[model samples]
Target: MTPFERSRGSWTFPFPGLSLARSPPDDRPTFWTRALGETPEVYGERLREQDDATWRAIDPTRSKLGAALCKGLRELPVPPRGRVLYLGGATGTTASHVADLVGRRGGVYVVEKSPRPFQRLLDVARRWPNLFPILGDAREPRTYLSWVPPVDALYLDISQPEQAEIATDHARLFLRSGGGLVLALKVPSLRKGGGRGPLSPAEEASRSLSRSFDLGPSVSLEPFHRGHFVITGHYRGTGREA
Candidate 1:
């Protein structure tokens, strides 16, 4: 089976954080990421050690990105040693996993506006060499643009009315022409009455993003997250490669 597929309730690891083993015969597949460093439990996730490496179980219920992967997201832009700029990285739960995926060579620059969670994110970043925390609003990307370098992937999970617009602005600024874009579209944040006619909020966001991105596999985070869609694609803005 491909990395994204679930065969008989068992999953194959997709990218950098590969699985150590298949799930038990009676249980469903569990996703695991190799711990980045000598880490303590973050968010109380289960941990195990094998082959001289620590692995942490990623709970889909608490993570939109994990939910998308659990629901069989066909494509993920994050590659090993790939730099990522993560917006709305609340308390570093999901950002920690992203750091594990990228390993020591690559880094994840996380931006969070709220001071409360940003404090916790700072603590998390202390333990993770590859994780960087920035206290700034994702909507105003320029506020933290100086801190973030050009990245291979840009991920947005902000709860804002202009999520797509924010992503577009950041993509043009930080993402390389062929870099990846992963966004968690929150429907409730869209304009009341669903914004555009007939089309759902996810569709509307996808349509707007299509102008600059070559949209790829879009997954619904159902059962784990309601009214959430994880959109994946590559940036095709000006000067894109042929």
Candidate 2:
């Protein structure tokens, strides 16, 4: 039988670490991830109990990765039981879901620069032993080199002008060759008030990423997040630094 059964609103496993179901009264599609352990309601997401599994809905408006999935960007590199290094994991909203997706066997090394959000992230980490929180700067990826291993995928969502540069830098050091990459590129950061040039922000970011990665589709997070695009790629490990 297929994962999604329309006759009964049962949870369907689509991507690694994710579940899908139709919401009641409307039949609208909903995204969910299985909770690894006893985790409190970190975010205000609804939880459902069915088939002896607890699932939490991923809020697209709050999570860029969730918005990318809801928007139908399919090249997710994060595999089941694979390691991931998540940059800019603010308060662990998306990171929590990722941890659930990776399950107990995999690990998620989350790096958050700020202290306030990092504190909240610490609280979330306690619930999932596999989640390791690092309070450090993403711009300086080497600082946390000891904390992370050669990951199967790298997820970047920092709000910096050098978004593409940062992703490539970290990928070079941590991600294995041909590993998957997901970047949440904020358009305004790249433009910096500059008028539209021959290349759009997404195009410019793509150009920069093409140096170190075999680029894939770039999905736009529209109403949920204006001026944000999620770019997926595979690290080639052959291109020179941009």
Candidate 3:
């Protein structure tokens, strides 16, 4: 199935919180334009000229995609022209940067369930050629599994009480054997009680993933954002083991 391919014309989806506008002027300031230390005008100019088929934004307030991009560039073993599956791709912000990094030869499959954010994601995909956006629930991998086969890396940024489980399910089904995974788990979302918990949210997530994969190094994005943890790991075995 592979979902729909990227197109240049306008398209619509059922995203709840997305507000689509005509592509902003080259001078309009975007959060990412600032975060990456590029003037809005400069960033906008570059975006306008970029011919890549896939592009998206990296909203800092909503997810740690921006922070993880900054950190992953320094730490993660992201290879050039690699494939990436981005879960919880709200509004396509972070997905865009990833597309840029991977370039035209590579690909990014962005799955977002929220109708609001999915709307914006649709809009961004119009210009970026390498980005493939799927408007569906990430929890139900079977729904989109046929369309999304194994990839070199799986990046998740879903904020839900069962985030760890959701991420693991995707990895088990779609991640290539020995592929890497980047999970941005939101602690508060997983809180069982109002404030009376013994094990922290992070601890629970780590333990859950360890059941299947060999959990690797993890880093808290507190220095860049609050209450976010980026955990990275590899699938437990070769294709034969699974």
Candidate 4:
């Protein structure tokens, strides 16, 4: 299942955060949130809408990005034809949908440290040409820099205690001017070690990101994932402070 169709004409921000989508006529209204097409699809169930078109249901429970969209996230920082650097690619679940969202013009460079996950990501990439899977660590952005172009956005879902630092490092290396960044802060990662410095995990990440990007509102993936926060922003580059 792949690209084609957004929520509506001219309203492309993040694609399909429609007021109508929140409450549809069906009992399972939230099941199918489409950018185009009418037939409702199941979560994780991939289906072909046409000979040349395919759509995969983005399960809110399975993906934080999906949860954010369902939770009234007004803007999608990643634009059409925009390149994205997906940290912690994680078997290509969310990465596949993102690849679909970007279409053929744009590409997503996914970095996964583990071999098991990278192998699965490779399988997903075969179906979609826009997805490029890299067997590398997210902490070392430079290791995979040569494989990626100047990306339009950087999305991090790594569980490292220093995940924010890891994401920021990549942004500084690869993100272009005005690029979007979405960092999923896993609170438990920091909580286990009693944390360091004075600031809380979320505040520290926000402060660090603020240095290079003009951040937007953040949302908690409550009920879906406990103590998970998704933060989005636009990179202004390192030389020119935001």
Candidate 5:
């Protein structure tokens, strides 16, 4: 879908620390530059020179969400200004971009299990007022379920072998009816055996997700990154049971 056709919901809250304004309508080149994994130096220079608020430096090696956002922006549902729950918000790289997409009016509750990543995520959250970083495991939804209300979307990028199951569990609790979900499945994490196999690892991962949700169209990022797939699904009109 074209950017103009994309849906824009009401703004909930505009955080003070997030000073970066959206890029100008004519700045297609700038959008591509930020979409691709521009070097930190380049990203910083560009941000400073252009005074652009929408652009941020993302570590491609660490974040499949970043890669997916770059390519799958069009597919992501426009979230309501209510709330968003992001699982596996490692270091807040992709979470920050999501915060931008959700805008200040919306609330983004990011959950991360690792203390190391949680620390960094906290730092990123401090800069973006709308983001609330929760240090907890995605596998255990009950731990953080009370902290977040029902949300418009659930974004999952955890690399666990049972990543699909984990995401589904959280979706059941946090996602509102007709809410959206985006999952970045790591094929190797779900693979059972080593060496070149007849059944592609990605196919297996896809099957696992298909069992729980109506797997929507997917974007294969193998050209940009190896063994990675970005899958988006919605709870609405999906007959699958929780």
Candidate 6:
């Protein structure tokens, strides 16, 4: 099989983090850079050569979601042409990849609380018509609930101790039956116990999610993104009482 080979089109890549890696838009050379790092000068997108096709490089090493997928994620669970509620879309790096996955028929409603990141999300939304960026706090789903339509999936990348609670609130308000969800749990942000092992904050989050969502297999984003766990699943039952 060719490196470019996948179940999807020629533009797509097998790596889920990078939905599709087309030849770099420009002739600019692309090289690896650390995630969340600032570059010295403005450089256009770069192409990564696998076989004959030069793929666009959306480094999974640079993204936590991408790292999790590289570590061993199974499925996206996001249906084609489905609506999605994206919580904590920061600058649209991962969100942009997700928007590509959904395509024009599908839409992603991104909620960002802070203004700085929200501005970046807006820029990404402009390029991708399917993306809808909303500047609102995720703590209160009702605050921006009207901006988002009922969705088939929900993705959260927020960094707060109340990650699970926040996910539950948004899920109840937006996700429909059998809807998919991917929650990125920032383990270190959660309260740390006296000792640590493979045990993660997602465990508590998953247990909390049991009240409503049936979770799928979870994996840790170690080495690439230490102290992060990825959770995938769908809404299952009425959530736990407050």
Give TM per candidate.
Answer: 0.89, 0.90, 0.69, 0.82, 0.72, 0.76
lDDT-wise, the better of 2 and 4 is 2
Clashing pairs in 2: 17-101
The sequence of per-residue lDDT tens digits that candidate 3 reaches over residues 112-155 is 99899888787777766777999988878789877875677788
Better of 2 and 5 by lDDT: 2
Q: Runs in model 3 with CA error above 4 Å? A: 1-63, 69-73, 193-198, 237-242
RMSD of 3: 11.3
Model 4 residue 134 distance off true place after TM-score fit, in angstroms = 0.1
Q: Which run of 10 residues does model 6 get worst, by summed lDDT?
A: 34-43
Model 3, position 223: C-alpha lDDT score = 65
lDDT of 3 at 134: 95
Query: Candidate 4 lDDT, tens digit per residue, 27-102?
Result: 2323232223233232345343433344455677888887776666667799877788899988887777777677
The number of the candidate with the highest lDDT is 2
RMSD for each of the candidates: 3.9, 4.0, 11.3, 5.3, 7.3, 7.2
**Model 3 lDDT, full chain set:** 0.62
Alpha-carbon error at 120 in model 1, in Å?
Answer: 0.8
- Model 3: ten consecutive residues of lowest lDDT: 33-42
| Residue 221 in candidate 1, Cα distance off native in Å | 0.7
Evaluation by lDDT, superior candidate among 1 and 2: 2
Model 6 quality (TM-score): 0.76
Taking all chains together, the TM-score of candidate 3 against the true structure is: 0.69
Give me the displacement of residue 166 in model 3, in angstroms.
1.6
| Candidate 5: 10-residue stretch with minimal lDDT | 29-38
When 2 and 4 are scored with TM-score, the better candidate is 2
Q: Please provide, for model 1 over 90-146, each residue's C-alpha lDDT reduced to its tens digit, 9 standing for 90 to 100.
A: 999999999998889989999999999999999899899999999998877888877
